[model samples]
Target: MVQLNLVKVLLLSNERTGDVRYEIFSKEGENPDYPEKIIVYREGNIGEHGERG
Candidate 1:
């Protein structure tokens, strides 16, 4: 069986909104179709200072 885990981190800014960052860590062998590596996913407004949902 293959197991996958995900970690999410929130980055805040000085404005009014921030960006949602995601870090994906996997422990799998390097495969052509399923290559194991560190992936980063970011979205939303960056450099914002406020509460985020």
Candidate 2:
């Protein structure tokens, strides 16, 4: 026998505004096990005002 599970997630960005991101995850089997997952949607950058240093 096999089992499945579904997961949904939403992400939003304030810098751009009105922008959103979506993600979905699925697992198989009754006792599915996996390592942690990391998602980096944004990167650090100098603001329009310019860097202080």
Candidate 3:
């Protein structure tokens, strides 16, 4: 698989209200099945009103 470059990973929120987004980052070569130790990052909480929380 190709290595992810951009830290931001756009995705539909579980709420499914609208275009909510987040960012994820992990160490290079880290396996999801056997991750020894990895770091993660998530950003923002936008509501229907389009405000950061």
Candidate number of the best lDDT: 3
Cα lDDT, model 2, residue 26: 46
How many angstroms is residue 16 displaced in model 1 relative to the true structure, after the best TM-score fit?
Answer: 3.6
RMSD of 1: 6.5
CA deviation > 4 Å runs, candidate 2: 1-5, 15-17, 30-53
What shift in Å separates residue 40 of candidate 1 from its native position after superposition? Answer: 7.5
Per-residue C-alpha lDDT of model 3 across residues 9-28, encoded as one tens digit per residue = 55655434334554455445
Stretches of candidate 1 above 4 Å error? 5-14, 31-49
- Alpha-carbon RMSD to native, per candidate: 6.5, 7.9, 6.9
Give the distance in Å from residue 21's predicted Cα in candidate 3 to where it truly belongs.
0.7
For model 2, name the residue pairs that clash: none
lDDT of 2: 0.44
Worst 10 residues of 2 by lDDT: 31-40
Candidate 3: residue 1 Cα off by (Å): 23
Distance from true position, residue 17, model 1, in Å?
A: 3.1
C-alpha local distance difference test of each model: 0.45, 0.44, 0.47
Decide which is better by TM-score, 1 or 2: 1
